[model samples]
Target: MNFKGLFRHFTDMKHYFVVVLVVFAISFYLGWANSDRYSFFLEGQLQGLKSVSQSLSAKGNPQIWYFIFIFLNNAVKSVLIIFLGLFFGVLPLYMLVANGMILGYVLSLQTNESTLSVVLKGILPHGIIEIPVILIACAYGLKVGMLVWKMGGQLFLPVERRTARRELANVFRLSKTLIVAIVALLLLAAIIESTLTYWLVHL
Candidate 1:
């Protein structure tokens, strides 16, 4: 593996999330955005947990909540990876980074005393895998984005007719390999999120 290449590509990922930041801006402007989205989402899942502590009120079944939470985390992570790869040129990275910003913003807004518990037990467990998955996808996205910016539509045309055919062939190869690798990484993250995150958190 070209660790240097990988690092360089990933480092470029910061540029990609300009889109993510934009997304947060828009989401914040729209009604869908709120600091309480996290709390509301988590609350919906924990309805049954309140049975455990009626006075203080825990919510949901611990085990089910664990599975559901981790599953959603990785599912979104995978989608972000694919989006970044397909969109290329920092759009992917921006989407992923924007997600991080939203998380930070939302968490910071939490006024509850149990906010730490929600983060530690619910989020951190799977975030270990989830966050890395986003970063790796962003790495690949950065490389593709840079290549697109540098090459632009030149990959479609060639120096000559013969070169055009050769260029298209090369494009196909790059596209196939990149898509497969991105999807594989996303899948791996999803799996680890499902199994490891669940067991670790619930235990």
Candidate 2:
């Protein structure tokens, strides 16, 4: 997608960005505060992460295989968030919380300076794209949930067939844009993370 299109989408849906930011902050605080108490949980989580990375490294060139692995993983996840939003937006919210918490916990395991370095060198390179794409997916998913609710409410109205059809069409149109943007953003993020971020962090 062009920069203008992406910019317009972001500007048009500022509220969703705020929602994601708020959720991430809350989850981060919780993860930081409970890091010690949840040490075992974090250990298990780290192990799982390690295995995934290790598998990528085992391949001849981590950058290529890693990009594919991460792209597929993130694309599936983001798409699920968008589609699963139909369940009263619970799934998207849950995903944001879970991901934010995991990130917070992982960062908290290091010293403040180390955490800053990690975020700067490892995460930021791709996070600028990846995080926003995730938020957009969640936002669209939440919108779908709202549309479903509105449709449900409209069902009780005396003459709502046409209105309901219009709303459904709108949801479908918006969803198409969301899916396209999410896939494109995730693909770029995977490439940057697997190459640029990896190189920076290793350096």
Candidate 3:
């Protein structure tokens, strides 16, 4: 992979990163303050996560199996979010908000620092890598939507061939770079979650 190119693209797309941060912060505050109001909506999500945890605990799986599971699970979700941005960026936005709200609700459930610490330890080991990777995917996904919109405009103005070509090239390069970074980060995140994170939480 061309590291320099990837770095250039990331720097060029700083606005999207800002978007992710802003959305996450807004939704997190909402989840923290209004969790009770959205309890019905969040119930399913909470239950699903609970069920996954329970199943893992029940099976007592080997580390390798856990790693594989985490990687595939997260990879699927991440890719879906990235591709869903094709929907004029709405789907990706919804997912970002949903995840932030769920996290906020979870954080709100804890009454004390001890509980929060435990949760943070369990998540942070992998989350440090995972969260940024996810956000990057989201940012690139949103970029796809914007490019698509530009391409649409270009369709109506074939005279702007040079501009259209530039947009197309950018879209291709950005997608490739995001895919490489996300895959590598998710793999590392899976390893950490299945090993260091799992042990830390269990201990």
lDDT of candidate 3 over 83-169, digit per residue (tens): 777788887788788888988888888775565695677778898998888877777778777866776777767575737458557
TM-score of each: 0.46, 0.85, 0.88
Which residue runs does candidate 3 get wrong by more than 4 Å? Answer: 60-63, 112-116, 161-165
Clashes of each: 15, 0, 0
User: Can you list the residue pairs that collide in candidate 2?
Assistant: none
Better of 1 and 3 by TM-score: 3
lDDT of all predictions: 0.52, 0.80, 0.80
Better of 1 and 3 by lDDT: 3
Per TM-score, the best of the predicted structures is 3
Error of 1 at 81 (Å): 4.0
**Local error of candidate 3 at residue 98 (angstroms):** 1.0
The residue ranges of model 2 lying beyond 4 angstroms of the native Cα positions read: 1-12, 37-45, 161-165
* Clashing residue pairs, backbone N/CA/C < 3 A, model 3: none
Candidate 3 local accuracy as lDDT? Answer: 0.80
Q: Model 2, clash count?
A: 0
Q: Could you list the CA RMSD of all candidates, in the order they appear?
A: 8.1, 2.9, 2.2
**Of candidates 3 and 2, the better by TM-score:** 3
